[model samples]
Target: MTRSLIIAAKCIAFTCLLLAVVGVSLWSASRRVPKFYEHALTQQLPADELAEAADQLEQEVLDLQSEIQSQETWEVIFTSEQINAWLAADLEQKFPQLLPTGVSEPRVAIEDGLAKVACRYTSPKFSTVFSLELDSFLTETTNEFAIRIAKARAGALPVPLKRFFDQITARAEEANLSVLWTQQEDSPVALVKLPTNLDDVRSDVVIEVIEIEEGQIRIAGRVVPGVELQSMPQQPRFADASQPR
Candidate 1:
């Protein structure tokens, strides 16, 4: 009986040791910053250059707004650098409440048809770089856009989709936007229905293209005379500014 007890204790000790090793490995992974995120953080811009970039982004937005109001075809393109600048400086200064609690220092990288968005996430227990890989396209359904979230991670570790889905839903609710959640090839997709009519201007906005290419995103669409398009609020325009520190 003593021999059996000794063997049982030995087995228990081995199990405990194995669990400890696994726990430590996962902890380490959660703390390791991703290469893309690290590079984004290091590429800083001067204050003057940041302001110039922010101005350029605002100009593009204004132009798009004018075209939409005129009921004319319009196309706008934005570079990754210009967007990063605006996010770093103008967004926090002017719209500090835009981001959720415990999230800050947001940045983006556009490459190979993917837009990588990363931000610092802090919690009571830890702080890490949280990122999402996304791609947007017009769906087959009329006036619908699909924003596919390909992957989400915390530092170097993959994060569960539920947390992100909850956050997205909450944000959409706050903005008074309706989001339909679906899955494509195991990835969660958020379907946003674009308003066909601008109530204030009595026009229809049809978005034909949302293409993401290396280092840039291009949006092309047309507006036509119709009922008011003011059923939904217009998307916020991004302006160039400084890099997030």
Candidate 2:
């Protein structure tokens, strides 16, 4: 009986040791888990990095928004009629001689600011090359010079041309449009006195080669101002027949 009791006590002791070992292992594991979690949390980004990330994202968004705003802001568009008017005005002002006489009405249409123009000439006048010169002088060259030339050309001496140019110059100035002349260095072939009004001016005003080097006269006012502008009307269908003399 004593032996059996002793075996039972040994069994109980072994069980108690196992329970103590298990308790110690659980405590060690618990301590390790907290340390590991602390290290992991330390490696994670802090508040400042999060703020930087937010700032970077905000900057990107702002840049995109700015780009969109700029595009919309520059979207001002011009109609075809307005563009054609500008071209016609420019042509009249720039190359008074090169511009065809009968181009009073220009048919204009615009698709996306690209001008499509069809103009009717009073008579089959100047050569195609001369007309092209007029077109180039208006749109391709420095428009500022054209303005000055327009102003200067009105004061020209070649009777009819002089009057025509003068009219255009006055019209431009009255409309608050101004031009600058670069050809001032080239002495004028003839000196045309300025007339205050279009009616007082002679119809003819071309620069005759007076004294090629000296720039002396047969002088007429550079431009003959104002006449046809009042006369030309926009008509839907125009007859192609020339007026009988």
Candidate 3:
């Protein structure tokens, strides 16, 4: 081979080796679940108790099916605490690596009509700490809910969350997390969104948060028919402050 071709081949080989090393490093980082994560999974209800409750729910549904009319609306209530417990359990089981190494487990709450998410983000070097509150409106859809963080407060300063989410997107991609978060538009107020691809579980699921109060959250959904609540495709969903179209 000529000198130029030899140098080109070496460059390609080196590039491939570098990519392989980086891929292995990221895979290793993702495999070691944090020791503290075990605590999050311990809140699941006992199996026998859960089975009994399910049986009761099935019986009640049978009774309702025999007695109730077609247009009746039924709602289920989940307390903020109960929601948080379930959220913690889910993260520990499915997305433990979504929580970065230096950050604490995320906390989710609902106050008024907004969903509040707070976490302490420590720098990788462990030198600086940031307390961040992501405040968003939890819009409801048929299959899943959409969360748009309208504003984020880092300590005392309120800032647009797009940049913070951009950083998270970089890290999450690097760590191979299951969820994808993207800022759909260039505007500062554009929504950071994710598609809840949940077609396998429920064909038509409607989970809408109807009320948010001090300790309770009420969600209304149809369990009978037309369960096609697929998460809407991620698009430009939020309106800019200057252009509310």
Identify the superior model by lDDT, candidate 2 or candidate 3.
3
Writing each residue's lDDT as its tens digit, candidate 3 over 86-117 gives 44445556667766676665555556565555
- lDDT digits (tens) for residues 1-245 of candidate 1: 99999999999999999999998988888888767777877986888998899889989998888878775788999998899889887998999888889999888999878999999989999898888899998776557787878988887788877655667767787776666777666777777766676555556778889999999999998886544344433542212111111
What's the distance in Å from true for residue 240, model 1? 38
Residue 14 displacement (Å), model 3: 53
Can you rank all candidates by TM-score, best first?
A: 1, 3, 2
- What pairs collide in candidate 3? 142-229, 143-229, 204-227, 204-228, 205-227
Candidate 3 segments exceeding 4 Å error:
1-76, 83-95, 124-150, 166-203, 208-210, 223-245
TM-score of each candidate?
Answer: 0.86, 0.21, 0.42
Better of 1 and 2 by TM-score: 1
- Evaluate model 2: give its lDDT: 0.33
Off by over 4 Å in 2: 1-104, 108-118, 123-163, 183-245
- Per residue, candidate 2 scores C-alpha lDDT tens digits across 1-245 of 99999999999999999999997765444233222223323443455653454345445445534433333211122333333434444445655665446654333432221222334334443211101101101212211112112111111111123334456546556656553222222321111222223232344222211110111111111222236323423221212211111
